[model samples]
Every structure is written in structure tokens, then in C-alpha cells.
Target: MGFESVPSLPLEGLETVDAARRPVPASPGTTTTPGAADRAALRTDSARANGAATASPAPPDLKVVPLPVRRAEPGRDTPAAGRSSIIVLLQQVQEQHGYLPRPEVVRCAGEAGISVAQAYGVASFYNFFKLTPPGQHTIRICQGTACHVQGAQGLLERVQSELGIQPGETTPDGLFSLETVACLGACSMSPAVVIDGEVFGRVTSRQVPRILARYRRRK
Candidate 1:
């Protein structure tokens, strides 16, 4: 649940360009071409025959709408309060946009009357606050002393080579993000790497390609 020797930097407020950008619109266009309309009608009939759609209209499933998140307001509040404030703000941003974008973080901070530092402090403290978008799968390698003593470095190199990315970075195809954590507390199984939080302990460099292949198969 905790780690030591992890190299962490303070979170910074979102950039200006992001803050100024407009939210992306959802929903498909209703306007259709003559050809598209014919194709859609045929597909609809096929789907209905396949039981994908029922003859009688079915009620839409209930959707749980999340509450709007608000950022912390910088006051004489304690750091703990500030952290909660930041979390709230981030939640609001995510709720509105469906993801936490850096610019939104800054905009939310400004809207909440909090300082960028306050937002960054909270963002960096929590591992969940991703500065960049995550991949379909995430791979975390242990850099703890015990793991390092074993073959963690070699394992990391294997991952980098296979994924073509260094730690704290994601693949160009957006299939994986490689992160280095100080320790996973699996000292007994040194040189561990976790894919999607599932630990693979005593991992050797030779296993890197195989491990990656397994993940690729999943994708």
C-alpha cells in the first residue's frame, strides 16, 4: 500500500491550452445519407432477427449519474482539507469530461479558488491521478532494493525494449504504460512486475517477452 525511494514530483496545474479547449460532444449525428439509410435499415432488420433488438420497445437500463466534482478552495484550511478539495475537484472534472485532463485540473483549481500548487500537491500524492492517459493495460515494475538486487533492472530493460517505452511513459499505440514503483512489498519474490495489478514474482529478463506476449494476447 506504500512505497519508499519512489521518485515523485509535485503535480502542476493544467496548461492554458487545455483549459481553453471546449468539451467534446457526445451522441451520433442524426443526419444520414440515402445509401447509409438503406444500409442501416437492412442492418436493423438483421439485428432484430438475431434477437439483438426486441420487437417491443424495451426500457433503457438505469444509469447512475455521478455528482459533479468541485475543486478545493485555497483558504486557511489544513493540507488534509486541501487534499480532499483537490480530489473533489478532480472528480468533478472527470465526471464532466469522462477523464481527468491536465487542463481541466487547472481550470477546476482556478474555478475552486485554489492555487495550482494545491491542485498539484493533491494530484502527485495520489497514484490514481494520471498526468497522461493510461493504456488498455498497465505494467508496473518494482525498483525496490530487494528486487533491484535480483534482476529488476534487467527486467525493466526487457520491458522497455519490448514496449519501446521507458518507465513513466506509454506506448505509441496506447496499449501499455510502463511505470516504475519503488516496491510492491513482495520482497520474498524479488524482481517482481505487475500487469494490471496481478503480480508476477521472481521474474527474469528471459520472461519479459513471454509476459508481454500474454498481455498482447489479452488485448
Candidate 2:
């Protein structure tokens, strides 16, 4: 089955949360960036925090994650940790763990002085928060007016067949994920797909298999 299209979210600054009991904060703007390597580190942290070990060829070892340098805007002061609101704290959690893992949510809820239900409510209210871990690759198919008229849905089906997973689903091996966006704003390039931050415009369904193979070979 094909996946329904949803609106796309632009990259923006994550909100802050009220600090209590030393709530752990997220690294700055880590969630929405093109820094794949950095995201990989956060995924590692998230996996470890959730007590799930990534089955890799090498034996797992304790590692230290280097913190990114915090940059200040020209005039605006960044919200200080503990002074920010719940949104920012949730952003931190998502940044650290890829998505808001249930256990971390409970912990943050307790620290934020809110119930677990309230926390889930807040997380659900925002389209930005993902409740589950994403695949190693995130593929966004454009289903905007132009793309749809240009046969974007067919492209989506081709991807579905190639991955054997529908949109909003990750492959069983956790290698690829599919999602449909209302528009990528690349109207000129009607049939468009973005794989792992690389935009392939004017894409055709025939190209889907080759594109997926390239990614598979990459990592």
C-alpha cells in the first residue's frame, strides 16, 4: 500500500523546557541539520541510553561523544538551560536519542514536573518529535501539486516495491525508511526524491532501484 502525503517541516531552532532536577538538555540544532556524522553519534547515544546495542561487526566499547561548540547569534541570546520551556527540553531528548524513547520521556516528564501523559501529549502535538528510531536512511518523496501531477505517486510505489516497505515504515533490516511530503518546494523538478539529504530532482520511477542501490553501497 502507498503512504499518504504529509506536510514537510523546515529546519528550525528547537524549543526549550523548564529545568528541574538537572534535566539533560539537547545539543543545539542537532535534530534538523544535514550533519549526518553528528546524527550518527546521537543515534549511538540514543541506542545506548535505550539499552539496545547496535549489532555491528566490531565489539562494543565505551566511548565519549564530543560536544559541539555552541554558537551565539548576532544579537539574540540563546535560551539558557533550565530557563527554557518543555519544548526545548524535548528537542534535546530527540537530538540525543534520534526520537523520544518512552523511558526517556518518563524521565523528562518527571523532571519537567509533568505526567507521562502530558509529556506524550506535548510530543504528539509537535510534528517534529518522532516517537521511534528512524532507519539509517530517510527518503522523502515529493507529492506536491507539481510532483503529483508528474506522477509522484507512481514513484512512491516504485520505492515501496524496492524497499518492500511502505511510507512511514522502515525496512526490517533498519536500512531504509520512506516518507511522503506534501511538497519539497522543488516544483520545477516535479518528480523529486531526497535520499539521505541528497536531492534527486526530475526523478523517474525507473531510477528508484539504482538510487537505492547507490545508498546501500555508500554505507
Candidate 3:
């Protein structure tokens, strides 16, 4: 089954807790809703300051994730980490892991001093974030004007037949997920298909089988 859509959240800034014993202060314009974990992070910080034992931060081997841009709405709060900062964090997580896990969302939200609801909201608002696990290969077909003129229709059909899945759907084997994009900003490469970020321009129906074969072998 397809993933459930993410819920909407208040556009708010990240939450900040004092590393020192100072009560966790919410930076101006930041909305703070202290969760049990947030309180725990604070306790951990205090313990470490007082020479009590605490687990070291997660290893540096953490993955990079790609996050979405925060749209500035009238009611949105500005986080101390700022919108750009959170987006950068999300991007780093996605880049390293290929998908954003719920804990990462909570971690990122906590780091930003934002609530889990806000973090999940931001992650879900953009198409870039994959709350659900994705296939090994992500196939993006261009539906842009130039591509459309250059026989993207045929390419789409070929993709459907080859993968036995439509756009926005993943293969039964979970090897690939097909997506239609308006523009990949590669107008010169109209009728293009991107398999795992490698663009194949001027794709034709004849080439679809070969391309599918190429990806299927990786499975």
C-alpha cells in the first residue's frame, strides 16, 4: 500500500535548550513545546556539565539528508537554527540515509528546537522527503514542455510496461519507483529520464527496454 500522507503542522522554528544549567530558553520567534525527550536532553546536558555519565552523541558516521525549503508564512515562527538551518539538517540526513526516519525527524526537530509535529509537517510538506522507504533506484521521467514535445508520452508508456507500475508507484519487487516530474531543469535534454540522478536525454521508446534491463540487473 502507498504511504499515508503526512499531517500539516504549525510552521515554527526549532527549539533550543541551554547547554548550561540555564532553563531552556526559547529564542525570540521560536515556538517551544518541550517533549519528554527534550526534557531528557536537558537533563543529559546538565549531568554532563556536573560530571555525570551520559552517552556520547551519535557517531559521526551519520548520513546526510536532503530536506525541503520552509515557506515563510505569516504565522510561521523563526527558529534559532532558522529555516535554512533545519532544511540543511534534513538534507544531510536524507543524503546519508536515502530516506528520513521518524527518529531522525524527531532528532532534527529537537535540535532545531521545533516540535516533532512541526518537523514531520515540514518533512511531509515537500515531495523530496520520503517518510516511507524508497526502492533502490528512483526513476524520474520528465513531463516538461520540451520533453512532452519530444515524445515523453511514449516514454511514459514504456516505463509503465517495463516496470508494471505507474508514476508515483513502486514496483512489486520494490526495485524501482516511477515518478513524473514537471521539469528537471534539463530542457536541452528533453524526453529525459533520470535513473538515480543520472539523466538520459533524448530517450525513446526503443531504449526503454534496455534501460529497464540495465536497472533490473542491479536487483
Candidate 4:
């Protein structure tokens, strides 16, 4: 579903930042914590409960087993195949899957000869890699010092209201995502927003609707 823009309140006076002073985000890790453990716990508990309730013979106990390093098949090769580094393996995985699919990550562990837990740890440690699939469009709001002084905060709130989702969340239908960046290096475009890589400079809360509507129309 698309979002409807709320009427913007006026910012009396604010100064926009210059592009020259903007800094590169350089946020390589852009990492987030994974909920694999929680999922596993829930699965295990449900399985245990189900087993106890059944009158039939219970299944054998589950055991933790280390996965052996195996060559990835012809169509399943990790990027930089010959490398054994976990980081390299994950990079390859992210390159292919966009986000780290749990099954693909497990397969990666098998190919890299590392435990699944170890691979997940590595992926979760970095911020740049995403653990979940992203939406069709990505919207980045710059919240740098200059932009903030220019009322970037209100811009952010407007975005949140329009999207009906927080920075890390995707809409129910996965149409769009909202995220904040320290800077997009377009300080001159202070109070700027980037949607699908197109920068909108000198943006005001009032202009958000027109800019966002352009994308909504695409749907």
C-alpha cells in the first residue's frame, strides 16, 4: 500500500548545509543483530512440546553436529570461490542473495567449512550487509549537523509519518523502506533525501509529497 502525505508544519527559519562540508557515510558494517537464535529456540521448544504430547514413541534426541567443508556446486559457487575467509564467503553470499537468506547462509557455512553460528556472527557483525530482504525502493534521509540545523529532524518525522514505518522497517507490501544517514556527502543539498539513488536537494517538508508521489505513481 502507498502512503498519503500528512500536511507539513512550517519551519520558521533554518539553514541548509553545503555539499562541500558533507562527509561520506563510509558505514561499511551497517550491521544489525539477527533473530536466528530466537527462531531456533522457538522451533526447538515447539518440537519438544509436540513430542511430549504424543503417545507414540518420541524421536531420537537432536544433536549438534559440525558441518564439514564442501565444494559449492556448479551453480552455487561463492564469489572468490578459492578463498576460505568467512568475510569473503559472506560477501559472496550477499552479492548473490541481496540479503543473507538463512538457507543460503547455511550453505555458505558448509562451503566455507565454518559452523552456521560462526557465519551468522560474521554477517551480523557488519552494518553494510543486510540480514533481511529490502523493499522495492529505498529512501535515505540525511541527518547531518547542517541538515539538522536546517530542520532535518522535522523532515525525518514527516518521512516516518508518510511511510508508516520506522527507519529499519519495510512496509507490509514491501514497497518502500526508510533509513537515516549521517550524511550523503551532499551537504550543499542539506535537508536532502535520496530515493532510489536520485537526490532531491533543497528539500522542504512541503516538497516531500511531490517527491514521494513520483515514486508512488510508479506502482
Candidate 1: where is the Cα deviation over 4 Å?
1-84, 91-99, 114-128
- Cα lDDT tens digits for candidate 2, 157-183: 999998998877788888997888878
Misplaced by over 4 Å in model 4 are: 1-84
Residue-level lDDT tens digits of model 4 in 1-219: 122243342221233444324454568975433464355556667777788553333233343344555444433544333224556677887888778889988877776666688678767766556787888899988888878888898998988888898876778878887878878888887888889999888789888878778888888
Candidate 3: give its CA RMSD in angstroms. Answer: 17.5
Q: How much does candidate 1 score in TM-score?
A: 0.55
- Candidate 3 per-residue lDDT, tens place, 55-169, comes to 4442132333444555433234455334444566788899888778888977777666667787776776777777766788999998888999999988999889988887766
Best by lDDT, which number?
3
TM-score of each: 0.55, 0.56, 0.52, 0.56
Alpha-carbon deviation at 40 in model 1, angstroms: 89
Q: In terms of lDDT, which candidate is stronger, 1 or 2? A: 1
How far residue 171's Cα lies from its native spot in candidate 3, in Å, is 3.1
